[model samples]
Target chain A: MDRYAPPGAGSAAGAERPQAEVRVPEIPGLPAGIPDGGDAPARHEGGEGDAAAPEAELTPPSAGDRPAQGKSPFQALTVIGQIEGHVSLPSQNKTTRYEHVLPQLIAIEQDPEVQGLIVLLNTVGGDVEAGLAIAEMIRSMSKPTVSVVLGGGHSIGVPIAVAVDRSFIVSTATMTIHPIRLSGMVIGIPQTYEYLDKMQDRVVHFVVANSRISQERYRELMFRTGELARDVGTILVGRDAVREGLIHEVGGMAQALASLRAMVRQGGRHQR
Target chain B: MLYSIIPPEVVLRPADGPAAVLWEEVEASGARRLILRRDADGRVVIERIISTEPRDYLDPALQPGQPYHPGRRE
Candidate 1:
């Protein structure tokens, strides 16, 4: 009876009580000596509670949990659908409101833990002012930034794609370079044409200033005829965009992230 | 003025009628403010989460287009 008592329970009182040997259900993959919950002594030392502690330490918290600690240092901002400006488009039309993006950009810039930013663009573009405003924000951000043109980055998206520290375009992506034009009823006055030309100049200057494309070549792409069936513009695909000096490289996500990480490391060294 | 590759005719097309969608802002758990709207199937769907905390954006449950049930704690 004394020999039957557990090593921890080594008293006459322990020997008097019935030592019911409890057995844990054998699970296939689990080790043989898993203690049953009803067994107090074994549970206290190496039971469910003790088992869970090491597992919690081994596995990181999921994204749904407190992700701030476990999240990646770099943040990704996707600019897809239409770049919605002042007016909200119909619900059917997918739009990326500037109001939403602007605030998020501010937050990203302010987050000290965030090391860098990667802007993924697949926009058909929208209002010139709104696009330029977004472009300016990305350009002015002190943190290392990179933009990747995935599907298409046409018209106003061109400026935004080039606004980053380095830009990459997937091999199949296409970018349309065309002059800005009024959508609704336009009063056919000389002033209206001048206003349109001035707006176009703004986009041209922004692209030329931030990219390797010369002003003349960009303008040629904008005003070139016989390219689009209806409109006058040049459709640059992948390497053509890199060759035109608009996008920095013609690679996908891998190149973009690698370049951004390198830039972030370099920036961190500089700050240190 | 718009500068897009999409045609002006398609881009500026007028809506058939005013949207009848109902949007409501509700206070969710963890001090999160969520803008919700009912979908076609009558499930309350998340339109957006309005919070200054950047960490809120990382929450998968609070992402846009996800269904939101009131009084349910995840």
Candidate 2:
């Protein structure tokens, strides 16, 4: 009879029982062996599959392996939608809260690894004080900074666009220069107009100090009539802003990043 | 005072309904606080990581919209 025959088939069944009992543990050991051996091949198949899709493979695994591995020296801060101030705007309105941005700016400034900042402004503009507060913070930072205005940087966005060391406006971008006006409650006293005028002056002064635009010309643009259908303001688009001396150049992301990099290189040399 | 071209009436309009999702701050491992909310599937998802350290922002697990597994260590 074959030694490996089934337990019930052979005359030696009783004698083979001890051998079969010893082999029973090997049945469970097969599954354990698959995990040890199968895991490597499964991983190899996965690695091969990942190699087929290079772009997808690159970001996720690298991001997972080392989150801070490819940290860029330059950080971008996007100021979009409306700038929300002290009072929280209704949830419906898309607003950039100053509280969130202010701390990030501080963190960017304090981080030694961060070499420069790029402010991307695409705002319709909101709260006067909040906008000015953010603009002032950007202006005060010692590190090299650049601003790029894409789409529209209207109203209070003007000061922020100019607050950086250099500014660029995409060819299709537009900026509206307008006098500040109160919307909600007005006391109707002469003091109300005086108070608003003073607020306007703060914006005007900040822009004039930061950019090449003169106060007289800026006021001219602010109070210009017949341009806006209902309001008295001048809309400066692309090269018009540069020609008027409100923006440094008529360009987009490439120019903005290039200028910022050059500025950072120069700043590094000076520090050394 | 607002300086935008958008009208005040449009800017200050009230939302139609109560907010659907509310984010609550939860303390996680490594002294990190995460703003999180449960999704439609009832899975806890991170909304934002509030940490003073800039390096904390780079953590892939702590990214916004990432699933927050309660017992996972940093």
Per-prediction DockQ scores? Answer: 0.08, 0.12
Give the lDDT of residue A266 in candidate 1: 78
| Model 2 interface RMSD over true interface Cα atoms | 23.7
Runs in model 2 lying further than 4 Å from the true structure: A1-70, A184-187, A268-272, B24-35, B47-65, B69-74
Q: Which residue pairs clash in candidate 1?
A: none
Worst 10 residues of 2 chain A by lDDT: A41-50
By lDDT, who's the top model here?
Answer: 2
For model 2, how does the per-residue alpha-carbon lDDT over A124-170 read when each residue is reduced to its tens digit? 99889999999999988988988999999999999999999889999
What is the clash tally of candidate 2? 0
> How far off is residue A38 in model 1, in Å?
49
| lDDT for residue A63 in candidate 1, whole number 0-100 | 31
- TM per candidate comes to 0.71, 0.72
